[model samples]
Target: MLGQALLMALRALRLNLLRSLLTMLGIVIGVASVVTVLAIGSGAQSQVTRQIRAIGANVLMINPGAARQGGLRLKAGTRATLTEGDVDAILEQVPQVRAAAGSIAGSAQAVRENRNWNTTVNGTTTNHFVVRDWTLSSGRTFNATEEAMAGKVAVLGSVVARELFGTDDPVGAEIRVMNVPFEVVGVLSPKGPDQDDVAFVPLSTAKLRFLGSAGGTARDAVAYILAKAVSDEAMARAKASIEDLLRQRHRIQDDQEDDFKVQDPSAAAEAQRGATRTVAILLTSIAGVSLLVGGISIMNIMIVSVTERTREIGIRRALGARGRDIRLQFLCESLVLCLAGGLVGVVLGATISLTVARSAGWTTVIDPSAVAVAVGFSAITGLFFGLYPAHRAARLDPVEALKAE
Candidate 1:
């Protein structure tokens, strides 16, 4: 009985193919929009996760700033409280800590023979590379002797190398930072666009040269410290130990606020994922409005169909066709229209996603669950909107309908 109703519904729809196609347009656009937005959002979350993991999720960053308070958080490096001693204490006293490194950063103009480019210059110890998990693409990292002697040697990030040397190898090249000449000892592997625009120099050299204090005070202060846990499971212990050691060294009372902040990348990444999910949900809701519009169109068309077939409905009722059968037949027509539109929309959405990924370089991840939801929602919309029209058709008075025409 259900199969016969579906076939009759299809035959009725075939009588006005163009009108049927036009009626399904709204459903198609709504489903496509939902699928595309979800795909892009999921892809962005994945990309963010991958980029954060690349920087080492087990690593923690300690910056000199008080904890955030009432929408007023001190920016990193605003306080000069963090020092080399804090780095040493964390490495020596924290058993869960594997390595720690401190760095101070400032931007400088890098000049070669005839080429010049501005880049971020970081003054860091040898362990900075290890803590960051950064590997050299060519040549080697500055030696301990160079670091200890405050040698004027630099390691170039991939972008710095390309900008300064173009197609030529940057190792063994001499580039002057802030008019102070330094030898380029190595080029680092690519670390995305943001990280690739930086250059690194020995801490001793920067302190002796570019980072001298204005008041002739001790220049042992560092901007931030990077630390790596011995293992993923040890991160919490490492954080706790460092907090305890710094509190003692900084002489902060038990009730006093801390003058520093520690951050975990994993927690930040999770927060980002939450924000992404919220945005995706908001976008899907907007797309749902289109589905609502499509359902209304279906209802209007079904009502017109009932009016035009009033005499036929009466004829069928007089020939022993029950009201329930008439109702089911109309409901099936609505369902078939919506389901067909949903399937086409899925295909269209996927195609558009791939095209955007290729042309705009945006990430898109087409989740199967999103497709399922879109199709299922469309089917439900059909049933909900078609109910009134189906009932109206089923209630027609056979005697009156026959006598009218």
Candidate 2:
């Protein structure tokens, strides 16, 4: 009985192929839109997760708050409220902290004989590498003597190495920063394109040769401090301990706001994921409206089909076909239409996602679950909207239906 109903449904659809195709357009578009948006969101979330992992887990960044001078406010990082002493205090007091380091940054031009490149210069201690999970690709990092003596030594990131040496080994070579020559003791492994365009020098070297003296009390201040927790579970404890310690050292009362800010790297990644999810939900909702519209179209078309087939339905009823059989045929028709539209939609959506990913150089992850959901939702839409029309056909009197033209 089911096979016969499905065969009749297919035959009816085949007779009006163009109209069937047009009716399914809405469902196709809605499903495609949902799939594409989900793919893009998944890709963005994946990228953010990988980047956070690459930067090392359980990391915290500390920066000074705004600075006030003569009743005017200065930029946040410019305040210089944090110094090497703050780093020491955090390490000594915060038992959850695995490693901590202070770093300063500046822009400088590097020259190696005829070649020159502009890159970011970072001033950091040996522990900065541990905090950031950075490792050398070749040669070696600064020794204790080199760091303490403020030696003229440097490490090149991959971009800097390529820009200056063009595939040649940068280690054991001499490079000049701001026209002050320094020996290249190491080359850091590649991080990413944006992160690799940099050079690292001993903190003392950066302070002495590049930053110079700020005069007065701000002389020893660093740009920021980076700390790593002993484990992922210890991040919150480490952060709290550092904050409480800094507040006490700065002697801020309960009524006063903190003079520094502590940031959790994982929080930033979670925020990004939340934003992506929100956008995906919004887009998918709009697409769902389209599917509703498509379902309405299916009902309208099915009602028209029932009207035109009244004589045939009457003939079948006279031949002992029950109302349930009539209803089943109409329901099957709706289901088949929706399933076809959904399949087409999946293909179209995947194609669009791949094209955009290639054209824009973006990562896209197509989830199989999204495809299944789209198809299932479409089937449900068909059943819901098709119910009333199917029942209407089933209720028609055989005698009256036969009396119609």
The prediction achieving the highest TM-score against the true structure is: 2
How well does each candidate superpose onto the true structure, as a TM-score? 0.78, 0.85
RMSD of each: 4.9, 3.2
Model 1: how far residue 14 lies from native, Å: 6.3
Looking at candidate 2, the ten consecutive residues that score lowest on lDDT are 211-220
lDDT per residue (tens digit) for residues 1-405 in model 2: 989888999998999999999989988998898889889989999888877866777899999888888998887765668888889888898999989988888889999889999999998888888887888999888889987888999998999999999989988999999988899999998888877899999888888888653222566778889999999889888989999999999898999988899999888988988998899899999989999999999999999989999998899889999999899989999998998999999999999999999999988999999899999999999899889888988999999989879
Backbone atom clashes (below 3 Å) for every candidate: 0, 0
**Candidate lDDT values, in order:** 0.88, 0.89
- Give the local distance difference test score of model 2: 0.89
Q: Give the residue spans of candidate 2 off by over 4 A.
A: 1-11, 213-219, 253-256, 314-328, 351-364, 387-403
The top-ranked prediction according to lDDT is: 2
lDDT of 1 by residue, 160-179 (tens): 99999999999998999988
